[model samples]
Target chain A: DAGVTQSPTHLIKTRGQHVTLRCSPISGHKSVSWYQQVLGQGPQFIFQYYEKEERGRGNFPDRFSARQFPNYSSELNVNALLLGDSALYLCASSLAPGQGAYNYGYTFGSGTRLTVV
Target chain B: DQQVKQNSPSLSVQEGRISILNCDYTNSMFDYFLWYKKYPAEGPTFLISISSIKDKNEDGRFTVFLNKSAKHLSLHIVPSQPGDSAVYFCAEGGATNKLIFGTGTLLAVQP
Candidate 1:
């Protein structure tokens, strides 16, 4: 089975532009989470959705939002993007929220690199 | 303020030797601690995690130690291999179920 997959491996947007990144969760998985990783830093969780409802949210502003589709895929939308939004947007999937099976462990995809010009 | 922190920017260890990575957090509400290893240009992959209930947890060659009082944790890889080289991050989980991450430490295992 394939791991979590994210779309548009790279993206560029203007300071005031909006950006949307997509992710497909692993088969049979019901949870999808979004994270932003700045250069040289670890990932910070943005949002987590389970069963199409918001399960958790990070300390980000309203400019950052996300939704989970019926298929467990997710989209992360950032409005009025800022230069600091330049980072790798990662999508991680698990069997369920709160760390998943965590035995074989949680899986992460090659993230979408977003650069705000 | 950084709730989670990895003071060491990098670590170098010889192959077959032991590799140790450290992390610290300031939040008293953090109930879960985790270690994620990220390769350049790739997303972080969960390495190992330990709940606050236990001071120690182990999986194969990887072990995590948490000192709640000190707000510190450490990851140990025995007989470290060159393949283990990567940037390791420390994360803390709280009521929000969101992960707060540190700056990460680049670990290089010398052949």
Candidate 2:
């Protein structure tokens, strides 16, 4: 079985540009979540979608938004990107939403390394 | 403010020795704690986890101890092997279902 997969393993964008990162969840999984990991720091949750609905959101600003597809895939979009937006964007998938899925631990993709200059 | 913290940036241990990594969290609402291991260019993998209701949880060579009073948790690997070397992160989960993580600690097991 394939694990969660992310696209464009690497990307580069200029300040004020927009960026989109994509992710495909594992088979049979209905939850997709996005996270940001800066160099030398742990990942911070951005958004989580369950069954194509926004289930949870982190402290990220309006520039960050995400949507889940009918097939359970997801896309993370950052508008007017800033230099500070450079980081590894990770996508994770789980069986469902809520504590049960969280307790099961999320399966993560290799992540998209986004560099904004 | 960092809700989760791993004060030690790195740890080195001899093969076959025990390795311990510590984590501290400030949020009392955190109900579940987890550990993750990552290699370069890869996402973090799920490791062992423990609930706030339990003081200790073990799986094979790994054991996690949680001290609720101190809001501290520790991961112990016995008879560590070189393959165990990697960056380990501690994460806390609350009602939001989102995880807050600590700055990872790089562990190096020398042969």
Candidate 3:
């Protein structure tokens, strides 16, 4: 089966602009999560959706939001982007949520690289 | 404050040698710990994970050891190959289901 797939492999935006990143989870997966990775740093959690409900959220600002569709696809939106928002946005998918999926580990997409100038 | 940290920014090892990468986490509540490998321009790939209840977990050439008292974890790759060269990240998962990650450590395996 195909793994998690993210759209618009790359993007360039300006400060104050808005951008949307998309992700399609693996077939039969119902949980999707988003993370941001700055250069030289590991990925930081942003949001997690399970069964189309918001299960958890990270410390990101209100400018960041995400939602999962019935099909388990997800979209991450950033409003009023800042230069600090420039990073790779990753999407991960798993069979379940929370500790239930810990053993198998979440499968991640290649990520969308966003640049805000 | 960084809940998870990888103090070593990089590590270099000769092929066929063992490569060890360390990680420290401040949150004892974290129930699950995971290791991920990332190549340039790609998202992190799930490597192996260990439950807080377990002290060690191994798969193929990769082995992870957890020290609950020290709040430390290490990933060991035996007979390291050049393909193993990449940035490795340690992440902690808890009730929140979100992963708290450490600053990555770049491992370069020389042939």
Candidate 4:
């Protein structure tokens, strides 16, 4: 089976500009979550959507937002990006939420590397 | 404070030896712990996980041991292979389903 897929493997954006990162979950997966990984650091959760409903959010600012489509794909939008926003954005897909949300662990995409100049 | 921490920035081990990566968390509320492996320029891939209720969980050459009393966990890879060289991250799943990750430890398995 195909794993989660993300688009624009690499991107360059100027500070203050906005960017949109996209993700397509594996077949039959209904939950999509986003994480931001800065250099020399671990990934930090951003948002999670299950069945098009917001399930969880992280400590990110309002500048970071995400939404899920009916097809279970997801988009992460970052507004007024700052230099600190430069990082790899990862997307993970799962079957659903609850006890078994990560029974097999999350299937992650290769991730989109965003560089803010 | 970092909820999850991997104090060792890097570790080197000989092939066929056992590789152990340690993680510690400050949050006792975390109910699930997981280990992920990542190659350069790639997202994390889940390796093994153990629930708070269990002390140990093993799969193939991978095993995860959790110590709730110390809020610590470790991932063990037996007979480590050079292909296992990568960064390993420890994560904790909270009640809200949020996964907090550790900074990561770069493991280098020598042939």
Candidate 5:
């Protein structure tokens, strides 16, 4: 089966602009999560959606938001982007939440590299 | 307040030698710990994970050891290969199922 896939592969935006990143989970997966990875740092959690509900959210600013569709795909939106928003946005998918997904580990997409100048 | 930290920015090991990467976390609520490997332009790949209840978990050449008391975890790769050279991140998962990740450690295996 194909793994998680992210769109645009890369993007360039200006400060105060808005951008949307998309992700398609693996087949049969119902949980999707988003993360941001700054240069030289590990990926940080942003939002997690299970079965189209917001299950978890990270410490990101209000400018960041995400939603999952019935089909299990997800979209991450950033409003009024800042230069610090420049990072790789990664989307991960799992079979379920909590223990059901813990053992299997999450499959991540190549990520969308967003650059805000 | 970084909850997770990988103090070592990078590590270099000779091929066939063992490579050990360490991680430390401050959150006691974390119940699951995982390791991920990432290439230059790709997303992190799930490596292996261990429950807080277990001290060690192994798969193929990769083994993860957790010290709950010390709030530390380590990933060991035996007979490291050149392909193993990449940035490795350790993460902690809690009730929310969201993972808090470390700063990452780059491992360069030389042939």
Candidate 6:
């Protein structure tokens, strides 16, 4: 079976431009989460969606937004991107919101490497 | 303020030796912890996890120990192999299922 997948493995964009990253969760999984990993640092949570609803959010700025489609795929949109916005965007999926052991050891996708020049 | 912290930036160990990675957190509400391993250009993969009720959780070749009193935890890998070289992350979260991660520890396993 196919694991989680992300699109546009890498992209280069100018500052102030908008970017949308995509993700497809595992076939049977109902929850999808987004994370941002800066160079040399661990990933920070962004947003989570289950059954097309927003379940959780992180400490990121208001410029970041996300949505989950009925098919369990997700899209993370970053508006007015800054040079600091460059990082790896990861997508993960799990059975459900209250089901995962710690809500942490998720199955992650390879990630979209976003570069804001 | 950083809730989870992995002080060590990197560690080196010889093949077949024991490797210990440490993590500490300041959040008492965090009842669950997990370890994830990542390679270059790849996202982190789940390694192991432990709940607050238990002080230890073990999997083949990998084990995680938690000390709730001190808010510290460690991951032990016995007989470390070259393939084990990767960056390890410690995560803490609870009902929100929103994980807070540490800076990560890079393990370099030598032949």
Interface RMSD, in order shown? 2.1, 1.4, 1.0, 1.3, 1.0, 2.2
Chain B vs. true chain B: TM-score per candidate: 0.96, 0.97, 0.98, 0.96, 0.97, 0.96
What TM-score does candidate 2 get on C-alpha atoms? 0.96
In model 5, state the lDDT of residue B30.
77
Q: Per-residue lDDT for A40 in model 6?
A: 85
The list of candidate 3 runs beyond 4 A from truth reads none
Q: What DockQ results do all the predictions give, each relative to the true complex?
A: 0.62, 0.75, 0.84, 0.75, 0.82, 0.69
Judging by DockQ, tell me the better candidate of 2 and 3. Answer: 3
- Per-residue lDDT of candidate 4, residues B1-72 (tens digit): 548999999999999999999999998776788899999988898888888889999999999999888888
* Model 2 pairs in collision: none
Alpha-carbon deviation at A10 in model 6, angstroms: 0.4
Please write out the lDDT profile of model 1 over residues A50-92, one tens digit for every residue: 9999998878999999999999999999999999999999998
Candidates in order, TM-scores: namely: 0.92, 0.96, 0.97, 0.96, 0.96, 0.97
> lDDT of model 4 at residue B89?
99
**Candidate 4: clashing pairs of residues:** none
Instruction: Compare candidates 3 and 6 on DockQ and give the better one.
Output: 3
lDDT of 5 by residue, A1-117 (tens): 789999999899999999999999999999999999999888888999999999988899999999999999999999999999999999998888664546777889999999999
> What's the C-alpha lDDT at position A82 in model 5?
95
Local error of candidate 5 at residue B103 (angstroms)? 0.5
Cα TM-score of candidate 6: 0.97
Model 5 clashes, total count: 0
Could you tell me the TM-score of candidate 3? 0.97
- Once superposed on the true structure, which residue ranges of model 6 sit more than 4 Å away at CA? none
CA deviation > 4 Å runs, candidate 1: A99-105
Residue-by-residue lDDT tens digits, candidate 1, B46-102: 888888788999999999999889988999999899999999988876566567889
Task: List the candidate 4 regions with Cα displacement exceeding 4 Å.
Answer: none
Model 5: docking quality category: high
